[model samples]
Target chain A: MKLFTKYNRINLSVMAVVFVLSGIAYYLLISNLFIHELDESLNDYKDKLHVFIKQHNELPRFEFFEDIVVTYEPVNVALKKKFVLVSRFNAEEQKESTYRQLTFTEKIGDTYYAFNIAKPVEGTKTLTKTIAATTLVLLLAIVSGSVVLNRIILKKLWKPFYTTLEELGHFKLSRGYVPVFATAGIEEFSFLNRTLSGVMREANNDYRILKEFTENAAHELQTPLAIIRSKLDLVIQEEGLTDSQGLALKSAYTSINRLAKLNQSLLLLTKIENRQFAAVQAIDLEAALKEKLVQFEDFWNAKGITVTADLTATALKANTELVDILLNNMLANAALHTQQGGSVMIRLCPGMLRISNTAVSGSLDNTRLFHRFYKKAAHSQSNGLGLSIIKQICDVQGIGITYRFESGFHHFDLQWPV
Target chain B: MKLLIIEDEKDLSDSIRQYLALEQYTCEVAYEFESALDKICLNEYACIILDITLPNGSGLEILKELKRQGKEDGVLIVSARNSPDDKIVGLNLGADDYLSKPFHLPELGARVAAIIRRKSFSGQNQIVIDHLTLDIRDKTLKNNEEAVPLTRKEYELLLYFVSNKNRVVTKEAIVTHLWGDDVDMADNYDFIYSHIKNLRRKLAEAGCPEYIKAVYGMGYKFSIPS
Candidate 1:
């Protein structure tokens, strides 16, 4: 749930409870004041009656006034003076009405008489009801007003926070970009922005340093490797070398070559990760594949591996060098792994390419296939970086690649971006 | 022919000098940028083997200076920085060719030879070895005044052999030279042997003397049987 909605729910509920309790308390207080005033008038009326009886020295005539009713009863014993509330049927309105009654006993010329004075409370009750209805209407108006106001104001307040979240969602370490967060006026939001900026800056710095280290390490090894290779090339030319000695030299040469290729491959992977090849161009997929196949024709022919190609005209927009490496690695992988006298099939459509070669072994470990230095055969001469290079190229180019085993063939499917 | 070697690494420069010495080329060594600049300003050479990274300055500066001087010397850039940008920049700055470091020595020798041939001969380039003649321009082979048909790879292999004649060339070098280093056919020595066998048969059928010799487990050597 949104923060605004949650806050509004809690705020409005608490406001409603307070408003309702206050409204009931207010009605009770107002109605009690009205009843106290009516009781005061009733006592005043009794005092007036007593005064008149004393002044005249006889029973005064009973008269009805406003909503007050006065009555007298001669009793053998005097009754105590008190106030009582009673419900009585009214002849004028024909309905039950509440009244406040005052009763007392008085002796006039040796005869004790009981006097009762009562007043209807219908007006006070009606006033309290009207007040309560008005309070309820006011409470609803305040609650709805606060809800709308909080939604608009809180949305504006959290604008910077949401913007920061969106920017972080698109952050990429390989791009080496550190976003500059806008300064938020709110204290907590500003603090959050400052902290995130620092973290992103540090991450980008660390990434750049690591990439530079990889590139430098690869480059530094090249000169020595070249020197060793050249020295070996000259050493093997010496006359009168024994067969065993020549073989040892050849093995050392092969290892050095492998080392060189491994170093170069690592460097290339780093470059691709860094997005160093940024130049993009339109490439004719059919022409490029056909050209690469012709280059590999001699190798396939020597191994007696037949190739079949079903191609359509397809074009892709990507870095030229990366595309070339991608194609080279894919084709080389197919040729190297296919058994002698086996067949390799290539099919290309508008946005997909599939290459399937006769399986030399069972299905490979799909999870570890594209990992660096993942070799299917333990003693294979390949540096085991071909598939990794192909994978890296596809990832950087936004192409989808998958491997599968079917019909005794290892199939690699590539989905091109539209 | 004279060539200049501008490289910071002394061991590599010495090895290059030793290998090229067998080809009867006089090589001058410059271990730093100042000496390289001084040498280029003072003399003319058939080619200059330049390294991109030097002690005092970049070898690209030397290439730019050479172009500014308008000298006809061929330049072959050999750098360990295999980045495509460096290669493009070097070639764009008028360097004749760019060869990344850790390259096979025979490949280096071939590139240098091709640059020198292109610069000196001005398109009329040919290599005549006894009864065999190679037309570099047309990429054809002639055995005793009769044209011998050669496939593209076979012709390139022959040219590479003739460039570093009498020197043992590893099968690894030949494979990388023909199919490039990216092909990863290191275990396919049989393929190399077969291709060499075909070239030998074709040359032998043309009544040429046997020139290519397999050097006991090391590699192959193409030389006049002496």
Candidate 2:
């Protein structure tokens, strides 16, 4: 961001343009004045010579060079021309000594003749150096002036925006309130801030309402479900029932069990989304997996499934609860998907776990595998939240999980930091 | 053995009590927190089944009560809130183990049995099978002062096989229990076969006939012949 701003570059460029322009204007004004002064000095010198000639009412003399040597040549030329024109009346002995001549122009008149002189002005090196020095100094002044000016302008321009940002930065969940102040003379900024505050207010209101609903729903519905399952069990145990009736009750029990798992997964998803997993701990990944494997031995054994695990001794930075959920979900999914005589392999390396089971179905749409309510048509007991639970952990802990059905095997590969 | 059940739902508790009576373990129920606290203070139980949430307070509070009274030597926390937070909290508070709600009744029974063994015997320090007396602590097997030799996996397989004697332990259970989550590359049960063959060989060489027998595609079993 700071690189993009390039404040110094902008300031220097503006200052350079302003300084160059002012120097040009100053140079033009001073040069014009110098030319005007030179014209007046030359005019005075010419006038003095003209009066001197008129007083004697005679031709010019060379002795005039003693007083005004710089103008002698041009004045002498003018006086000689006047003598030639006046000599027609008195063919005087000779014209006054021709003093000077003008090479810039030709004299046309006699008594009132005109001469224009131009001297070669040289050695302007010092003048050029002085101008260069002054220009540099002016450039510096302009740069400093622009910086100061921009400071004032930017402060006023960004004031209300900064104020709003500061207030939002300090906003807390307890108050859920953001301070609003009117923007000064900026329609766009005021409109942007107004829209932001409006959205924040609405989001907070909706969040509070939804949070209350989830909590109420979880609390209210839990007991009734427990009651229904328990009543079903009691009915089964109470008296002798026909086999068909028993099968019907067992099917009902199975659906209830599925519903219960669904409820748990949904509740867990909500809790994770709500940021309610407040616990943190350094979890022993290998030890936790080993424990879960130990617990699941019977589940696999009863179905004649073979489990081969290579769980190494590595630790992870995770909350124990979420870690348990992630591992249990994966293990359960593997156990549910694999065939009775098939092999389920779990390999835990540093920061990665690959769980692969023999695929019962030929191929699967691996894409939507982690989505909620996803289930293989053959394995119907899946409540469809196993991979999704792992996903929730992935989202919260920055872990990554990928699934693939390849070469008659279903593989779930989870990766995280070592 | 007498057990105490601390659960929230009444019907669930009743069903659990009925099941335990069928299993021949005397049981008591405390559906509320205060009643649970009262029960823990009053009686000495072999095992306590606990639930996390209750109307009066949390089952975790009762667990603390048991700990304070210095009587929470054996307990299993049975909870619908099967989150690992509740499990670790319960276990660290001196619970013998934990089981989640909607669990199979047999699983609950298994946890109860494991906990009772842990609280009762501290896990098989010594065992007897036929003429062999195995001291688990010293890792020694003797037939009344004559030491028996066994390989590493053989000894482990022996201990596990005997521990689950008579029960038809499945191949997966043996693999998990014996291997301890280490062999994901094993494609078959050939490893178990070699270990069993070696164990049987060493036992027969020690002037004793084979006590470890294979039940064929199932699992190995250790028993004294009738």
Candidate 3:
């Protein structure tokens, strides 16, 4: 449940318990006060009767009434003046009624006589009922009103927090767009916003510095390698070189070329991880695959490998250049791994693309296949980065890539949401 | 033809100067930004070879200055940073071509020659190599005024060999020149041998002179009969 609802429920429950307990206490106190007031009035009426009897020197004639009654009895039955509540039947009303009675001994002529005075107490009960009902209605109104008012106030207070949270969700370090946090009126929420903005700023700065270092390292490394390659080009043109020298130069040349390729691949992988290429659009994947296949037709034909394509139209949102690179690397890998006269197969379906080729050797080690520089064997023709690049692309696009060996052919399958 | 080399690396600039020296083009070297800018202000050349990164300032500044002065000299950007942003920006600033680093020297020579041709030879679209004449605009080859049919790859190969006419072109150089950063260097060079064979056969069928010769185990050399 929401915090506001929880707080309101607890608050109202406590108030309800207190209100009920106080209502019972109030009923007892008010009823006792009414009974005390009735006793005082009965005592005053008895005193007035004594004063009248003294003035007349005879027993006062008594009158019968509906709510009050005066009666005389023998002196031995009543010892002293006292008040008691009793229920009596009244001939006029024909029902039992509660009343306060005062009894006292008074001299009439020669023998002692007991006098009784009674008054009905029905108004006290009505007064208490009205008071209890009024208190309950007022309590209910206060509890519900405050709960609603609290909810509205809290929602307004938390508006800035929600805004900051939403902006933080959309922030990307690679894009270098920092979120602008709105000022929360409350102290703690504003402090939280400031701390988060500072943290993100530091993180973004670190990421940019690291990215520049990578690009600079790749650039710096290429210049010297180029100089070496150019000098080697001149050395190879010299007159009369021994076979060993030529072999040495050729080995160095090949190693330098491999180094350059490795650098470029590493740079490209870093850029992909950092999201340097963020522009994406809906592209026809089947058409892109066909174009790549055309580019590789000659390479495969030169190796006597046959390409079989089963294309079903597929479109996905992705960076076009990355898609081109992805397809090129995959096809090149397929061509490179297959033996002479081997066949390559490509299939495309809705939300999926599958490429399979005949492998000259047994199944490759699945664990190390996509690791950087994890070649199948030492001195293999591949730079060992093609599969790694594919893995990175799949991760960025939220695509799934699976590898399997079935029917003596190695298969790579890629699937994504349409 | 005249060219200015505005690269920060001395050894690379020296090698470029030496390679282009064989093409009979006058070459000047500027090792820093100030000197490169000075050279641009003082002289007019067929093309300017620019390096984006320099010690004193950026090579892009030289390109900007060249444009600001309205110098129509062809600019070919050579950068170690093979970023698309730089390529796009350079091309937008009127640079004719972009070549990534560690490129083969012969490939560089071919690009410079093509740039010079595009800039200097306005309506002259044909390159005459003895009896073998190549129509650059149509991408066709003609010998003794008779059309010789060639595939796209064959035509490109012919242009590369002709660009470095008599130089000994290695299989690695030919592959790098034709396939620009695409083909794996460790793979077999048989593709180059096949392409060269096709081009030679087509030339011979057209009654052209035997200009392309295989130099033992080295590579092929294209030249007039001696």
Candidate 4:
């Protein structure tokens, strides 16, 4: 999963396999050398027997040697000189031990005899075992030491990378502040940081440009829209206008007003996103909600919608303007969507606010509800930015908003952090 | 009373001037900052409708100039920037009111009239139209010294009509004026019709002539019947 863990798994496994294979090869090489030495000594013993037989005309006494056994056997045919290994039982130790034995034929006055000389290899075998055990212990120690050292050093070496990751996690485009990465000594990490810095710089630049464009476009539209509206106001006052003309002017006026509102909504959204309303103070939620309710009282009455409120005094630290807009948009949304004679209910607790209104339609598409210009009905008169504006204000104010439909009522809930 | 409109847009300035001209107020126009400053220095006006963004400089500078001269003229700032920052800064600089652009001319007229009334009338803030007397301070209406009770919205609607008397005010303007533009009630003006009907009934009961007339399908015009 982690880079260090993945590298260590592959590195340690390969090292373990190589170490075991080399250890086995080392053991075999050492044992072969021991056998070769034993063979040489046995051959020398055979040569000595020949010399003794020629010099003394008799076989040397076998009891004079230690750890070597010599034997003679009458043979019908002469035996070729060769080396062989044999296992013999030892009376004292009560165990079978391997010996290197040399067999040869010797002639004394036309009599043929077979001679076998054998020597015990128990010490060499013990020596090989000791060397093998020591090698295994040393290999294990080296592997474990390298593993521990690699973990510590690698962790320290990748410290800059983790720091970069943490800083990236906290980066925000709305803050408009680019973070400077700490210089790293490693080339690969340095390159990564450099690339990231360039990307963030570009992103911040693009964001600034986009924000300015939105503000400027909205601002520029305002004057022209004002001129058009003023001209319309003058035109409506002209004498001898027919009712049809008045209707046309009214429709035009409505469209122009809608356009103006849309522009203003976009501007407000941009402002909220830019964090322009940064002044924060403790706002009494109960008082604010009550005030908003009073403002919407006329609309509710006009639509014949019954209103119910259960409010508790709660305080939140947020920008006053933002809170006002958030409350206004939410209440307006509820008032606009509810059918005539529908009931609107509001409940406010310490950290939660819920506003639900009876709706003829079923649940709205929650996924697309907060997206700008997303409307449930094609013929709905709403510009579809009201909920989005509410969502934006809630986001800026650190409030969580959710929408749901239950029991023929559309419910909007706002949660504030304690 | 004399007024000065310092705005860069000629069409908008002319429209405002034309609208207020019907109220018997003389309006002078300045299309740039330097000319506006020259005019402000040269004359005393009852009100100055200042646009914040001018060709040469900001209108706030003109406000500062007015404050430097210690003039007591009422100043109303208009800007296309609907940002609260400009509004706050403009008000802080002693502008009497701040109106964002794309405003209804009637709303502008009402604000300008309010500013002039506050500046000229001082504490004796009242407007008399025929037998109807609107007490601005107490927010009440009187017919020949007989107190006429009016609801809060009725009073406000009556005051708005009195401010822009004899001129057609659209239902949209009245809706925005009463409930603000953020209420999303643009498509429905039935409530406005009811309010107007009630106001007319109440005024007619108080021996006031039929003053409010529906101008075809356009809107309402408050004037003495000819």
Using TM-score, give the best candidate's number: 4
Against the hidden true structure, what lDDT does model 1 obtain?
0.89
DockQ score for model 2: 0.09
Report fnat for all candidates as fractions from 0 to 1: 0.66, 0.09, 0.43, 0.61
Q: Over the stretch B14-43, how does candidate 3's per-residue lDDT look in tens digits?
A: 999988887788999999999999999999
Best-to-worst DockQ order? 4, 1, 3, 2
Each prediction's DockQ against the real complex: 0.66, 0.09, 0.37, 0.67
lDDT assessment of candidate 2: 0.67
Per-residue CA lDDT of model 4 for B1-226, tens digit only, reads 9999999999999999999998899999999999999999999999999999999899999999999999999999999988889999999999999999999999999999999999998879789988899989889999999999999899999999988888999988998898888646534777678778899999989888899988866689999776
Clashing pairs in 4: none
lDDT of 1 by residue, B4-92 (tens): 99998999999999999899999999999999999999999999999999998999999999999998889999988888899999999
lDDT of 2 by residue, A57-165 (tens): 5435545324323322234443333211111111132433222223222332443334433322212334446666799887877677767776787777878777777
lDDT of 4 at A168: 99
lDDT of each: 0.89, 0.67, 0.84, 0.89
Q: Pick the candidate with the highest DockQ.
A: 4
Encode model 3's per-residue lDDT on A216-313: one tens digit a residue. Answer: 78877898989998998777766577888877887887788788888888888887887767888998988998877766776787888899999999
Stretches of candidate 1 off by over 4 Å are A34-65, A69-92, A97-120, A123-136, A273-275, A298-308, A334-345, A354-418, B123-125, B183-194, B201-210, B215-218
Name model 2 segments beyond 4 Å from true. A1-4, A58-112, A119-129, A140-222, A238-248, A266-325, A331-384, A391-418, B1-8, B17-77, B80-97, B102-226
